[model samples]
Target: MDTWRQIIADDEKSWVLFEHGTCVVLTTPGDDLAAQAVSVLRDSGPVHPGTPAADFGTVPLETTPGWVITSHHPDVLTYVSPEEIAQDGDNTPLAAGLYGRSKRDQDAHSLTVIHVEDNRR
Candidate 1:
């Protein structure tokens, strides 16, 4: 089976499984990529199993610098600088449209923002 299929089958991680071929895995600020892959699945909310991946195409998370968003899907991820986030307002429309009043609403999807330490500084 494919890697994603295997992961889905295992169901042992914090995965925002969408209907399309896209999946967003969440991790704590201190968790490494490898660690997150195998870590026990935690409780996640606002799972939109019926929503298409295209709806999340523009949602951006405000995180610490150096935090990278990796994805196998072409053109599925983008880096949003702090300046851009600030200019967009306290709460971005894109995020509001998806997350709604509660960070994780039953009617919309939720995003988990992880802030990693900048070791270079």
Candidate 2:
């Protein structure tokens, strides 16, 4: 049910993320992050697998411009922005690094894995 559409920049062919029935341009990445943003937008966001027992962190799904990172994965966490934080109402967007329950300051949040197609060849 997550509908999507995109617009490429005239000069650079950059990606502009937009959803169906809305003009809220979520992001304008130079590459496929725009598609990932759309997928996350259609979904609940930060789609995560069950937490691992090792208490580790994983990479974050590259999110849209207005989305935030609230959970941690046990592999490769990434960076998010303030605008994304405010939009998602995430009080603590974890910085890209090691995360787990062992770390008193970081939450053991997890993220869903997303496969991005590399069209650059």
- On lDDT, the candidate that comes out on top is 1
List the candidate 2 regions with Cα displacement exceeding 4 Å.
1-48, 53-75, 94-121
Best TM-score among the predictions, by candidate number: 1
> What is the overall TM-score of model 1 with all chains considered together?
0.22
Candidate 2's TM-score: 0.21
Tens digit of lDDT per residue, candidate 2, span 30-112?
A: 35554454444333322344643323332333433322222232122223334434554553434322222222122212222
Q: Compose the digit string of candidate 1's lDDT tens values, residues 67-119.
A: 12222232222333344345456445454333321222321232232321212
Off by over 4 Å in 1: 1-51, 57-75, 91-121
Q: Which ten residues in a row have the lowest lDDT in candidate 2?
A: 1-10
